[model samples]
Target: MIMDLSKQVKIALDYIQSIDVSDIDDTSEAGRIFYEKFIPMAGEEETIYKIENLEVPSFEQTINIRIYRPSNEKELPVVIYFHGGWFNAGGLESHDRPLRKLANLSGAIIISVDYRLAPEYPFPTGLNDCYNALEWIILHAKMLGIDLKRLAIAGDSAGAALATVITRRAIQNNLNKILCQLLVYPVTDASLKTPSWQEFKDGPVLNYEGAVQAWNLYLPNIKEIENPDASPLYSDELSDMPSTLMIIAEYDPLRDEAILYAEKLQKSGVAVKQLLYKGMVHGFFQMGGIIDDGNRAIEETAQFLIQNFNK
Candidate 1:
Protein backbone atom coordinates (compact mmCIF):
# COMPACT_ATOMS: atom_id res chain seq x y z
CA MET A 1 0.00 0.00 0.00
CA ILE A 2 1.26 3.45 -0.87
CA MET A 3 1.45 5.74 2.13
CA ASP A 4 0.61 9.44 2.00
CA LEU A 5 3.46 11.89 2.35
CA SER A 6 3.71 13.88 5.54
CA LYS A 7 2.49 17.47 5.23
CA GLN A 8 5.92 18.98 5.91
CA VAL A 9 7.61 16.59 3.48
CA LYS A 10 5.06 17.49 0.82
CA ILE A 11 5.88 21.16 1.21
CA ALA A 12 9.60 20.42 1.09
CA LEU A 13 9.13 18.39 -2.09
CA ASP A 14 7.28 21.31 -3.66
CA TYR A 15 10.21 23.57 -2.92
CA ILE A 16 12.61 21.04 -4.43
CA GLN A 17 10.49 20.83 -7.56
CA SER A 18 10.82 24.57 -7.95
CA ILE A 19 14.57 24.30 -8.29
CA ASP A 20 16.27 23.59 -11.64
CA VAL A 21 18.27 20.52 -10.77
CA SER A 22 18.46 19.12 -14.26
CA ASP A 23 22.22 19.50 -14.07
CA ILE A 24 22.63 18.00 -10.62
CA ASP A 25 25.18 15.44 -11.81
CA ASP A 26 27.19 18.00 -13.72
CA THR A 27 30.40 18.95 -11.94
CA SER A 28 28.90 18.21 -8.52
CA GLU A 29 26.13 20.77 -9.01
CA ALA A 30 23.83 18.82 -6.72
CA GLY A 31 26.45 19.03 -3.97
CA ARG A 32 26.85 22.77 -4.48
CA ILE A 33 23.10 23.33 -4.20
CA PHE A 34 22.82 21.04 -1.20
CA TYR A 35 25.51 22.93 0.69
CA GLU A 36 24.24 26.36 -0.28
CA LYS A 37 20.50 25.87 0.17
CA PHE A 38 19.46 22.75 2.04
CA ILE A 39 22.21 22.88 4.67
CA PRO A 40 21.57 26.39 5.96
CA MET A 41 17.92 25.49 6.53
CA ALA A 42 18.68 22.10 8.09
CA GLY A 43 17.96 23.56 11.54
CA GLU A 44 19.99 24.98 14.37
CA GLU A 45 23.28 23.24 15.02
CA GLU A 46 23.50 21.43 18.32
CA THR A 47 25.74 22.84 21.04
CA ILE A 48 28.61 20.45 21.36
CA TYR A 49 30.99 20.39 24.31
CA LYS A 50 33.95 20.54 21.96
CA ILE A 51 34.82 19.95 18.31
CA GLU A 52 38.15 18.99 16.78
CA ASN A 53 39.44 18.45 13.25
CA LEU A 54 42.19 15.98 12.50
CA GLU A 55 43.66 14.07 9.60
CA VAL A 56 44.29 10.36 9.70
CA PRO A 57 46.92 8.83 7.52
CA SER A 58 45.46 6.12 5.34
CA PHE A 59 47.13 4.23 2.50
CA GLU A 60 49.30 7.04 1.13
CA GLN A 61 46.51 9.55 1.69
CA THR A 62 45.22 11.51 4.65
CA ILE A 63 41.47 11.32 5.33
CA ASN A 64 39.87 14.23 7.20
CA ILE A 65 37.87 13.49 10.36
CA ARG A 66 35.75 15.72 12.59
CA ILE A 67 35.45 14.79 16.22
CA TYR A 68 32.59 16.01 18.37
CA ARG A 69 33.03 15.55 22.08
CA PRO A 70 29.68 15.79 23.83
CA SER A 71 31.02 16.41 27.32
CA ASN A 72 34.12 16.50 29.45
CA GLU A 73 33.54 12.90 30.36
CA LYS A 74 36.68 10.81 30.07
CA GLU A 75 36.73 7.36 28.60
CA LEU A 76 33.37 7.93 26.93
CA PRO A 77 31.97 5.75 24.19
CA VAL A 78 32.53 6.85 20.58
CA VAL A 79 30.52 6.76 17.37
CA ILE A 80 32.42 6.89 14.11
CA TYR A 81 30.09 8.23 11.42
CA PHE A 82 30.26 8.45 7.64
CA HIS A 83 28.09 10.88 5.69
CA GLY A 84 25.80 9.80 2.83
CA GLY A 85 25.90 11.05 -0.76
CA TRP A 86 25.58 7.80 -2.67
CA PHE A 87 29.39 7.69 -2.21
CA ASN A 88 29.83 10.75 -4.38
CA ALA A 89 28.52 14.07 -3.10
CA GLY A 90 28.34 14.69 0.67
CA GLY A 91 31.22 15.53 2.96
CA LEU A 92 32.06 16.84 6.44
CA GLU A 93 30.43 20.25 5.99
CA SER A 94 27.33 18.95 4.22
CA HIS A 95 26.43 16.73 7.18
CA ASP A 96 27.75 18.86 10.05
CA ARG A 97 24.42 19.70 11.67
CA PRO A 98 23.04 16.16 11.96
CA LEU A 99 26.34 14.82 13.33
CA ARG A 100 26.39 17.52 16.00
CA LYS A 101 22.85 16.62 17.02
CA LEU A 102 23.82 12.95 17.09
CA ALA A 103 26.84 13.71 19.28
CA ASN A 104 24.77 15.67 21.77
CA LEU A 105 21.90 13.21 21.85
CA SER A 106 23.98 10.05 22.02
CA GLY A 107 26.37 11.58 24.56
CA ALA A 108 29.16 9.81 22.76
CA ILE A 109 32.16 11.34 21.08
CA ILE A 110 31.20 11.39 17.39
CA ILE A 111 33.98 11.00 14.86
CA SER A 112 32.68 11.97 11.44
CA VAL A 113 34.91 10.54 8.72
CA ASP A 114 35.12 12.40 5.44
CA TYR A 115 35.79 9.53 3.07
CA ARG A 116 36.75 10.20 -0.52
CA LEU A 117 33.86 10.32 -3.00
CA ALA A 118 33.40 8.27 -6.19
CA PRO A 119 33.29 8.80 -10.03
CA GLU A 120 36.79 10.10 -9.46
CA TYR A 121 37.91 7.78 -6.70
CA PRO A 122 35.56 4.87 -7.60
CA PHE A 123 34.95 1.54 -5.89
CA PRO A 124 37.07 0.46 -2.90
CA THR A 125 38.75 3.84 -2.42
CA GLY A 126 36.04 5.37 -0.20
CA LEU A 127 35.43 2.04 1.49
CA ASN A 128 39.11 1.63 2.24
CA ASP A 129 39.28 5.17 3.56
CA CYS A 130 36.45 4.45 6.01
CA TYR A 131 37.99 1.18 7.18
CA ASN A 132 41.36 2.85 7.64
CA ALA A 133 39.76 5.64 9.67
CA LEU A 134 38.10 3.07 11.92
CA GLU A 135 41.46 1.41 12.53
CA TRP A 136 43.10 4.73 13.33
CA ILE A 137 40.34 5.68 15.78
CA ILE A 138 40.71 2.40 17.64
CA LEU A 139 44.48 2.66 17.67
CA HIS A 140 44.36 6.18 19.04
CA ALA A 141 41.49 5.57 21.45
CA LYS A 142 43.48 6.35 24.58
CA MET A 143 44.76 9.68 23.32
CA LEU A 144 41.33 10.59 21.97
CA GLY A 145 39.74 9.92 25.38
CA ILE A 146 37.53 7.25 23.89
CA ASP A 147 36.68 3.98 25.59
CA LEU A 148 37.65 1.39 23.03
CA LYS A 149 35.36 -1.15 24.63
CA ARG A 150 32.23 0.86 23.84
CA LEU A 151 32.86 1.86 20.27
CA ALA A 152 30.08 1.98 17.67
CA ILE A 153 29.83 2.62 13.94
CA ALA A 154 27.07 4.56 12.22
CA GLY A 155 26.05 6.33 9.00
CA ASP A 156 23.11 7.29 6.83
CA SER A 157 22.42 5.90 3.32
CA ALA A 158 25.66 5.13 1.51
CA GLY A 159 27.52 5.78 4.68
CA ALA A 160 25.39 3.15 6.40
CA ALA A 161 26.46 0.68 3.72
CA LEU A 162 30.06 1.52 4.64
CA ALA A 163 29.32 1.05 8.31
CA THR A 164 27.94 -2.44 7.71
CA VAL A 165 30.86 -3.39 5.53
CA ILE A 166 33.31 -1.96 8.07
CA THR A 167 31.66 -4.00 10.82
CA ARG A 168 32.04 -7.13 8.75
CA ARG A 169 35.68 -6.36 7.98
CA ALA A 170 36.33 -5.63 11.65
CA ILE A 171 35.02 -9.04 12.59
CA GLN A 172 37.15 -10.72 9.93
CA ASN A 173 40.24 -8.88 11.14
CA ASN A 174 39.26 -9.62 14.76
CA LEU A 175 39.25 -5.92 15.52
CA ASN A 176 36.18 -6.50 17.66
CA LYS A 177 35.81 -3.25 19.57
CA ILE A 178 32.66 -2.27 17.66
CA LEU A 179 29.52 -2.64 19.80
CA CYS A 180 26.74 -1.60 17.43
CA GLN A 181 25.68 -0.17 14.09
CA LEU A 182 23.11 2.63 13.75
CA LEU A 183 21.97 2.67 10.12
CA VAL A 184 19.53 5.36 8.97
CA TYR A 185 17.74 4.30 5.81
CA PRO A 186 20.80 2.60 4.34
CA VAL A 187 21.33 1.62 0.72
CA THR A 188 21.79 -2.09 1.22
CA ASP A 189 21.74 -3.32 -2.37
CA ALA A 190 23.36 -2.05 -5.52
CA SER A 191 21.01 -4.03 -7.77
CA LEU A 192 18.20 -1.53 -7.16
CA LYS A 193 15.65 -4.23 -7.95
CA THR A 194 13.68 -4.35 -4.69
CA PRO A 195 9.91 -3.91 -4.55
CA SER A 196 10.28 -0.57 -2.75
CA TRP A 197 12.62 0.59 -5.49
CA GLN A 198 9.90 -0.01 -8.06
CA GLU A 199 7.11 1.41 -5.85
CA PHE A 200 8.98 4.57 -5.00
CA LYS A 201 10.92 4.77 -8.25
CA ASP A 202 10.09 8.44 -8.50
CA GLY A 203 9.77 9.31 -4.85
CA PRO A 204 10.51 12.81 -3.67
CA VAL A 205 14.04 12.57 -2.30
CA LEU A 206 15.73 9.59 -4.00
CA ASN A 207 14.49 7.89 -7.14
CA TYR A 208 15.26 4.60 -8.87
CA GLU A 209 17.13 6.20 -11.76
CA GLY A 210 19.20 8.23 -9.33
CA ALA A 211 20.07 5.10 -7.37
CA VAL A 212 21.13 3.33 -10.55
CA GLN A 213 23.25 6.29 -11.49
CA ALA A 214 24.84 6.31 -8.07
CA TRP A 215 25.76 2.66 -8.34
CA ASN A 216 27.14 3.06 -11.81
CA LEU A 217 29.20 6.04 -10.74
CA TYR A 218 30.51 4.29 -7.70
CA LEU A 219 31.34 0.98 -9.34
CA PRO A 220 33.43 0.94 -12.49
CA ASN A 221 32.13 -2.49 -13.49
CA ILE A 222 28.59 -3.81 -13.06
CA LYS A 223 29.97 -7.00 -11.50
CA GLU A 224 31.14 -4.94 -8.53
CA ILE A 225 27.50 -4.47 -7.63
CA GLU A 226 27.40 -8.04 -6.34
CA ASN A 227 30.60 -7.69 -4.33
CA PRO A 228 29.84 -7.98 -0.60
CA ASP A 229 32.10 -5.09 0.28
CA ALA A 230 30.28 -2.84 -2.14
CA SER A 231 26.84 -4.15 -1.25
CA PRO A 232 26.39 -5.44 2.31
CA LEU A 233 23.24 -7.35 1.36
CA TYR A 234 25.48 -9.54 -0.79
CA SER A 235 27.72 -10.50 2.13
CA ASP A 236 28.17 -14.22 2.50
CA GLU A 237 28.09 -14.23 6.30
CA LEU A 238 26.52 -11.79 8.74
CA SER A 239 26.56 -13.86 11.90
CA ASP A 240 29.22 -11.85 13.71
CA MET A 241 27.95 -8.43 12.67
CA PRO A 242 27.63 -5.93 15.48
CA SER A 243 24.24 -5.41 17.14
CA THR A 244 22.19 -3.23 14.77
CA LEU A 245 19.55 -0.52 14.83
CA MET A 246 18.19 0.30 11.37
CA ILE A 247 15.71 3.11 10.71
CA ILE A 248 13.63 2.69 7.56
CA ALA A 249 11.28 5.10 5.83
CA GLU A 250 8.04 3.73 4.38
CA TYR A 251 8.28 5.70 1.13
CA ASP A 252 11.90 5.09 0.27
CA PRO A 253 13.19 3.10 -2.68
CA LEU A 254 15.82 1.56 -0.40
CA ARG A 255 13.24 0.41 2.16
CA ASP A 256 12.87 -3.25 1.30
CA GLU A 257 16.61 -3.89 1.04
CA ALA A 258 17.17 -2.33 4.45
CA ILE A 259 14.40 -4.48 5.98
CA LEU A 260 15.73 -7.58 4.29
CA TYR A 261 19.20 -6.87 5.64
CA ALA A 262 17.78 -6.59 9.17
CA GLU A 263 16.07 -9.94 8.76
CA LYS A 264 19.28 -11.48 7.46
CA LEU A 265 21.20 -10.15 10.44
CA GLN A 266 18.64 -11.56 12.88
CA LYS A 267 18.79 -14.95 11.23
CA SER A 268 22.56 -14.83 11.49
CA GLY A 269 22.15 -14.52 15.29
CA VAL A 270 22.97 -10.83 15.46
CA ALA A 271 20.76 -8.74 17.73
CA VAL A 272 18.69 -6.44 15.52
CA LYS A 273 16.13 -3.64 15.93
CA GLN A 274 14.32 -2.10 12.98
CA LEU A 275 12.06 0.92 12.97
CA LEU A 276 9.83 1.72 10.01
CA TYR A 277 8.70 5.33 9.98
CA LYS A 278 5.34 5.57 8.21
CA GLY A 279 4.59 8.39 5.77
CA MET A 280 8.27 9.32 5.71
CA VAL A 281 10.56 9.41 2.69
CA HIS A 282 14.28 9.16 2.09
CA GLY A 283 16.67 11.68 3.71
CA PHE A 284 14.12 12.55 6.42
CA PHE A 285 16.68 11.89 9.13
CA GLN A 286 18.73 14.81 7.92
CA MET A 287 15.70 17.12 7.80
CA GLY A 288 15.20 17.67 11.51
CA GLY A 289 14.56 21.36 11.06
CA ILE A 290 11.74 20.76 8.63
CA ILE A 291 10.59 17.31 9.79
CA ASP A 292 9.65 16.39 13.35
CA ASP A 293 10.47 12.73 12.73
CA GLY A 294 14.16 13.59 12.26
CA ASN A 295 14.59 14.76 15.84
CA ARG A 296 12.54 11.85 17.21
CA ALA A 297 14.70 9.37 15.28
CA ILE A 298 17.80 10.98 16.68
CA GLU A 299 16.52 10.47 20.21
CA GLU A 300 15.61 6.88 19.50
CA THR A 301 19.00 6.33 17.85
CA ALA A 302 20.80 7.80 20.84
CA GLN A 303 18.87 5.57 23.21
CA PHE A 304 19.71 2.53 21.13
CA LEU A 305 23.41 3.37 21.09
CA ILE A 306 23.41 4.01 24.83
CA GLN A 307 21.75 0.69 25.52
CA ASN A 308 24.36 -1.14 23.46
CA PHE A 309 27.20 0.84 24.98
CA ASN A 310 26.00 -0.09 28.47
CA LYS A 311 25.92 -3.75 27.50
Candidate 2:
Protein backbone atom coordinates (compact mmCIF):
# COMPACT_ATOMS: atom_id res chain seq x y z
CA MET A 1 0.00 0.00 0.00
CA ILE A 2 1.20 3.54 -0.84
CA MET A 3 1.89 5.85 2.06
CA ASP A 4 0.32 9.22 2.58
CA LEU A 5 1.62 12.02 0.39
CA SER A 6 3.95 14.60 1.86
CA LYS A 7 2.36 17.89 2.94
CA GLN A 8 4.01 19.69 0.06
CA VAL A 9 2.82 17.16 -2.51
CA LYS A 10 -0.75 17.27 -1.23
CA ILE A 11 -0.76 21.06 -1.44
CA ALA A 12 0.65 20.97 -4.95
CA LEU A 13 -1.96 18.52 -6.23
CA ASP A 14 -4.75 20.55 -4.68
CA TYR A 15 -3.51 23.64 -6.48
CA ILE A 16 -3.32 21.78 -9.80
CA GLN A 17 -6.84 20.48 -9.40
CA SER A 18 -8.13 23.97 -8.74
CA ILE A 19 -7.25 25.12 -12.22
CA ASP A 20 -10.21 25.46 -14.61
CA VAL A 21 -9.99 23.49 -17.84
CA SER A 22 -13.43 22.02 -17.91
CA ASP A 23 -14.00 22.56 -21.61
CA ILE A 24 -10.49 22.54 -23.01
CA ASP A 25 -9.47 19.26 -24.59
CA ASP A 26 -5.81 18.84 -23.67
CA THR A 27 -4.95 17.70 -27.20
CA SER A 28 -6.93 20.30 -29.08
CA GLU A 29 -5.80 23.73 -30.26
CA ALA A 30 -7.03 25.29 -27.05
CA GLY A 31 -5.18 22.68 -25.05
CA ARG A 32 -1.86 23.27 -26.75
CA ILE A 33 -2.32 26.99 -26.24
CA PHE A 34 -2.99 26.44 -22.56
CA TYR A 35 0.00 24.17 -22.07
CA GLU A 36 2.26 26.54 -23.98
CA LYS A 37 1.11 29.31 -21.70
CA PHE A 38 1.20 27.23 -18.55
CA ILE A 39 4.66 27.88 -17.24
CA PRO A 40 5.19 25.05 -14.79
CA MET A 41 6.01 26.40 -11.34
CA ALA A 42 9.75 27.05 -11.72
CA GLY A 43 12.47 27.79 -9.27
CA GLU A 44 14.71 30.86 -9.49
CA GLU A 45 16.60 30.70 -12.77
CA GLU A 46 20.34 30.22 -12.52
CA THR A 47 22.70 31.49 -15.15
CA ILE A 48 24.95 28.73 -16.41
CA TYR A 49 28.42 29.66 -17.66
CA LYS A 50 27.33 29.13 -21.25
CA ILE A 51 24.05 28.43 -23.02
CA GLU A 52 23.23 28.30 -26.71
CA ASN A 53 20.52 26.96 -29.01
CA LEU A 54 21.24 25.03 -32.16
CA GLU A 55 19.26 23.28 -34.88
CA VAL A 56 20.02 19.88 -36.32
CA PRO A 57 18.35 18.70 -39.47
CA SER A 58 16.27 15.55 -39.05
CA PHE A 59 14.43 13.36 -41.54
CA GLU A 60 11.18 15.01 -40.50
CA GLN A 61 12.33 18.53 -39.70
CA THR A 62 15.00 20.59 -37.98
CA ILE A 63 15.49 19.54 -34.36
CA ASN A 64 16.12 22.34 -31.88
CA ILE A 65 18.66 21.63 -29.14
CA ARG A 66 19.61 23.85 -26.24
CA ILE A 67 23.17 23.48 -25.00
CA TYR A 68 24.14 24.43 -21.46
CA ARG A 69 27.74 24.55 -20.32
CA PRO A 70 28.23 25.08 -16.61
CA SER A 71 31.94 25.84 -16.84
CA ASN A 72 34.60 26.93 -19.28
CA GLU A 73 36.66 23.78 -18.93
CA LYS A 74 37.60 22.05 -22.19
CA GLU A 75 36.54 18.50 -23.09
CA LEU A 76 33.89 18.37 -20.37
CA PRO A 77 31.67 15.37 -19.74
CA VAL A 78 28.23 15.86 -21.33
CA VAL A 79 24.72 14.53 -20.86
CA ILE A 80 21.95 14.72 -23.41
CA TYR A 81 18.45 15.32 -21.97
CA PHE A 82 14.96 14.81 -23.28
CA HIS A 83 12.08 16.54 -21.49
CA GLY A 84 8.85 14.71 -20.57
CA GLY A 85 5.30 15.85 -21.24
CA TRP A 86 3.63 12.57 -22.01
CA PHE A 87 5.01 12.73 -25.57
CA ASN A 88 3.26 16.00 -26.39
CA ALA A 89 3.45 19.06 -24.14
CA GLY A 90 6.87 19.76 -22.66
CA GLY A 91 9.66 21.64 -24.43
CA LEU A 92 12.66 23.87 -23.61
CA GLU A 93 10.83 26.57 -21.69
CA SER A 94 8.72 24.25 -19.59
CA HIS A 95 11.95 22.59 -18.45
CA ASP A 96 14.49 25.44 -18.57
CA ARG A 97 14.71 26.23 -14.85
CA PRO A 98 15.35 22.64 -13.79
CA LEU A 99 17.84 22.07 -16.60
CA ARG A 100 19.78 25.08 -15.43
CA LYS A 101 19.82 23.70 -11.91
CA LEU A 102 20.88 20.29 -13.20
CA ALA A 103 23.73 21.79 -15.22
CA ASN A 104 24.93 24.06 -12.43
CA LEU A 105 24.79 21.35 -9.78
CA SER A 106 26.35 18.67 -11.98
CA GLY A 107 29.14 20.89 -13.37
CA ALA A 108 28.79 19.06 -16.65
CA ILE A 109 27.73 20.27 -20.06
CA ILE A 110 24.06 19.55 -20.89
CA ILE A 111 22.29 19.25 -24.20
CA SER A 112 18.47 19.27 -24.03
CA VAL A 113 16.52 18.10 -27.05
CA ASP A 114 13.21 19.55 -28.25
CA TYR A 115 11.66 16.67 -30.14
CA ARG A 116 8.47 16.81 -32.18
CA LEU A 117 5.16 16.17 -30.38
CA ALA A 118 2.59 13.55 -31.30
CA PRO A 119 -0.98 13.13 -32.66
CA GLU A 120 0.81 14.97 -35.44
CA TYR A 121 4.42 13.82 -35.47
CA PRO A 122 3.64 10.42 -33.88
CA PHE A 123 5.78 7.41 -32.82
CA PRO A 124 8.88 6.78 -34.90
CA THR A 125 8.95 10.47 -35.83
CA GLY A 126 9.75 11.70 -32.32
CA LEU A 127 11.97 8.71 -31.62
CA ASN A 128 13.88 9.29 -34.84
CA ASP A 129 14.26 12.97 -34.07
CA CYS A 130 15.82 12.25 -30.68
CA TYR A 131 18.16 9.61 -32.12
CA ASN A 132 19.23 11.79 -35.03
CA ALA A 133 19.90 14.69 -32.70
CA LEU A 134 22.09 12.50 -30.50
CA GLU A 135 23.83 11.11 -33.54
CA TRP A 136 24.59 14.61 -34.74
CA ILE A 137 25.89 15.65 -31.33
CA ILE A 138 28.14 12.58 -31.16
CA LEU A 139 29.43 13.34 -34.64
CA HIS A 140 30.28 16.88 -33.60
CA ALA A 141 31.45 16.23 -30.03
CA LYS A 142 34.99 17.35 -30.70
CA MET A 143 33.85 20.54 -32.38
CA LEU A 144 31.50 21.15 -29.44
CA GLY A 145 34.41 20.59 -26.99
CA ILE A 146 32.70 17.69 -25.23
CA ASP A 147 34.37 14.53 -23.89
CA LEU A 148 32.93 11.67 -25.85
CA LYS A 149 34.46 9.23 -23.39
CA ARG A 150 32.16 10.47 -20.60
CA LEU A 151 28.95 10.97 -22.53
CA ALA A 152 25.65 10.02 -20.88
CA ILE A 153 21.91 10.32 -21.51
CA ALA A 154 19.02 11.34 -19.24
CA GLY A 155 15.26 11.85 -19.49
CA ASP A 156 11.90 11.61 -17.66
CA SER A 157 8.60 9.82 -18.38
CA ALA A 158 8.20 9.34 -22.12
CA GLY A 159 11.58 10.88 -22.58
CA ALA A 160 13.16 8.24 -20.34
CA ALA A 161 11.75 5.54 -22.54
CA LEU A 162 13.47 7.25 -25.44
CA ALA A 163 16.74 7.49 -23.55
CA THR A 164 16.86 3.77 -22.80
CA VAL A 165 15.79 2.86 -26.31
CA ILE A 166 18.63 4.96 -27.68
CA THR A 167 21.06 3.47 -25.19
CA ARG A 168 20.07 0.00 -26.40
CA ARG A 169 20.29 1.10 -30.02
CA ALA A 170 23.75 2.52 -29.45
CA ILE A 171 24.84 -0.79 -27.97
CA GLN A 172 23.40 -2.64 -30.95
CA ASN A 173 25.19 -0.43 -33.46
CA ASN A 174 28.43 -0.57 -31.45
CA LEU A 175 28.24 3.19 -30.83
CA ASN A 176 29.21 2.90 -27.17
CA LYS A 177 29.64 6.46 -25.97
CA ILE A 178 26.75 6.50 -23.47
CA LEU A 179 28.29 5.61 -20.12
CA CYS A 180 25.18 6.11 -17.95
CA GLN A 181 21.49 6.98 -18.01
CA LEU A 182 19.27 8.81 -15.49
CA LEU A 183 15.56 8.13 -15.59
CA VAL A 184 13.05 10.05 -13.44
CA TYR A 185 9.64 8.44 -13.08
CA PRO A 186 10.18 6.74 -16.42
CA VAL A 187 7.18 5.33 -18.32
CA THR A 188 8.65 2.07 -19.65
CA ASP A 189 5.80 -0.37 -20.32
CA ALA A 190 2.97 0.71 -22.58
CA SER A 191 0.73 -2.22 -21.67
CA LEU A 192 -0.39 -0.27 -18.57
CA LYS A 193 -1.03 -3.51 -16.75
CA THR A 194 1.10 -2.98 -13.68
CA PRO A 195 -0.23 -3.04 -10.12
CA SER A 196 0.66 0.62 -9.86
CA TRP A 197 -1.36 1.24 -13.01
CA GLN A 198 -4.40 -0.20 -11.28
CA GLU A 199 -3.60 1.55 -8.03
CA PHE A 200 -3.03 5.02 -9.39
CA LYS A 201 -5.57 5.01 -12.18
CA ASP A 202 -6.79 8.32 -10.82
CA GLY A 203 -3.40 9.86 -10.41
CA PRO A 204 -2.62 12.90 -8.31
CA VAL A 205 -0.96 14.23 -11.47
CA LEU A 206 -0.87 11.57 -14.22
CA ASN A 207 -4.11 9.63 -14.58
CA TYR A 208 -4.57 6.29 -16.38
CA GLU A 209 -6.86 7.54 -19.12
CA GLY A 210 -4.56 10.43 -19.97
CA ALA A 211 -1.58 8.10 -20.16
CA VAL A 212 -3.40 5.67 -22.42
CA GLN A 213 -4.61 8.57 -24.54
CA ALA A 214 -1.12 9.95 -24.96
CA TRP A 215 0.13 6.53 -26.05
CA ASN A 216 -2.70 6.27 -28.54
CA LEU A 217 -1.93 9.69 -29.96
CA TYR A 218 1.77 9.00 -30.09
CA LEU A 219 1.33 5.46 -31.37
CA PRO A 220 -1.72 5.08 -33.62
CA ASN A 221 -1.42 1.36 -34.04
CA ILE A 222 -2.50 -0.26 -30.77
CA LYS A 223 -0.51 -3.40 -31.50
CA GLU A 224 2.72 -1.38 -31.50
CA ILE A 225 2.74 -1.41 -27.71
CA GLU A 226 4.52 -4.75 -27.85
CA ASN A 227 7.16 -3.52 -30.28
CA PRO A 228 10.13 -2.99 -27.90
CA ASP A 229 10.73 0.05 -30.06
CA ALA A 230 7.62 1.53 -28.44
CA SER A 231 7.98 0.00 -25.01
CA PRO A 232 11.50 -0.58 -23.67
CA LEU A 233 10.11 -3.11 -21.16
CA TYR A 234 9.62 -5.55 -24.05
CA SER A 235 13.19 -5.13 -25.34
CA ASP A 236 14.85 -8.56 -25.54
CA GLU A 237 18.36 -7.35 -24.73
CA LEU A 238 19.16 -5.34 -21.63
CA SER A 239 22.72 -6.57 -21.41
CA ASP A 240 25.46 -4.02 -22.17
CA MET A 241 23.17 -1.11 -21.34
CA PRO A 242 24.66 1.80 -19.43
CA SER A 243 24.70 2.27 -15.65
CA THR A 244 21.21 3.46 -14.69
CA LEU A 245 19.68 5.71 -12.03
CA MET A 246 15.94 5.23 -11.88
CA ILE A 247 13.94 7.70 -9.73
CA ILE A 248 10.52 6.28 -9.01
CA ALA A 249 7.53 7.72 -7.16
CA GLU A 250 5.54 5.45 -4.92
CA TYR A 251 2.18 6.96 -5.87
CA ASP A 252 2.83 7.05 -9.61
CA PRO A 253 1.05 4.92 -12.17
CA LEU A 254 4.33 4.15 -13.92
CA ARG A 255 5.98 2.91 -10.73
CA ASP A 256 5.71 -0.80 -11.37
CA GLU A 257 6.89 -0.57 -14.95
CA ALA A 258 9.97 1.42 -13.93
CA ILE A 259 10.73 -0.98 -11.12
CA LEU A 260 10.35 -3.92 -13.46
CA TYR A 261 12.67 -2.32 -15.98
CA ALA A 262 15.25 -1.61 -13.34
CA GLU A 263 15.06 -5.23 -12.22
CA LYS A 264 15.56 -6.33 -15.80
CA LEU A 265 18.64 -4.12 -16.10
CA GLN A 266 20.06 -5.51 -12.88
CA LYS A 267 19.41 -9.08 -13.95
CA SER A 268 21.20 -8.40 -17.21
CA GLY A 269 24.43 -7.37 -15.44
CA VAL A 270 23.86 -3.62 -15.69
CA ALA A 271 24.46 -1.68 -12.52
CA VAL A 272 21.12 -0.20 -11.49
CA LYS A 273 20.30 2.25 -8.72
CA GLN A 274 16.72 2.94 -7.70
CA LEU A 275 15.24 5.74 -5.58
CA LEU A 276 11.63 5.54 -4.54
CA TYR A 277 10.27 8.82 -3.21
CA LYS A 278 7.68 7.68 -0.71
CA GLY A 279 4.96 10.27 -1.20
CA MET A 280 5.73 11.70 -4.58
CA VAL A 281 3.74 11.51 -7.81
CA HIS A 282 4.79 11.35 -11.45
CA GLY A 283 6.68 14.36 -12.89
CA PHE A 284 7.88 15.62 -9.52
CA PHE A 285 11.50 15.82 -10.66
CA GLN A 286 10.67 19.05 -12.46
CA MET A 287 8.41 20.40 -9.77
CA GLY A 288 11.03 21.95 -7.50
CA GLY A 289 8.84 24.89 -6.71
CA ILE A 290 6.21 22.61 -5.21
CA ILE A 291 8.26 19.88 -3.57
CA ASP A 292 11.71 19.84 -1.98
CA ASP A 293 12.28 16.35 -3.43
CA GLY A 294 12.40 17.84 -6.90
CA ASN A 295 15.58 19.77 -6.16
CA ARG A 296 16.94 16.81 -4.24
CA ALA A 297 16.33 14.62 -7.29
CA ILE A 298 18.43 16.96 -9.40
CA GLU A 299 21.26 16.90 -6.89
CA GLU A 300 21.16 13.12 -6.75
CA THR A 301 21.08 12.98 -10.56
CA ALA A 302 24.12 15.22 -10.81
CA GLN A 303 25.97 13.06 -8.32
CA PHE A 304 25.18 9.91 -10.31
CA LEU A 305 26.17 11.43 -13.63
CA ILE A 306 29.39 12.76 -12.13
CA GLN A 307 30.14 9.32 -10.75
CA ASN A 308 29.85 7.81 -14.22
CA PHE A 309 31.99 10.58 -15.74
CA ASN A 310 34.71 10.07 -13.16
CA LYS A 311 34.74 6.35 -13.84
Q: After superposition, how far is residue 106 of candidate 2 from its true place, in Å?
A: 0.8
lDDT by residue (174-255, candidate 2, tens digit) is 8756899999888888889999988989887888898888888888998898989789999879988889999999889999
Candidate 2 lDDT for residue 88? 75
Give a tens-digit lDDT track for model 1, residues 94-199.
Answer: 7889889888888999999999888888989999999999999888889999998898999999999999999889989998667999999998889888898888
| Pairs with backbone N, CA or C atoms under 3 Å apart (clashes), candidate 1 | none
Candidate 2 lowest-lDDT run of ten:
30-39
CA RMSD for every model? Answer: 1.7, 1.7
- Give model 1's TM-score versus the native structure: 0.95
TM-score of each: 0.95, 0.95
Between which residue pairs do clashes occur in model 2?
A: none
Clashes of 2: 0
What's model 2's overall lDDT?
0.86
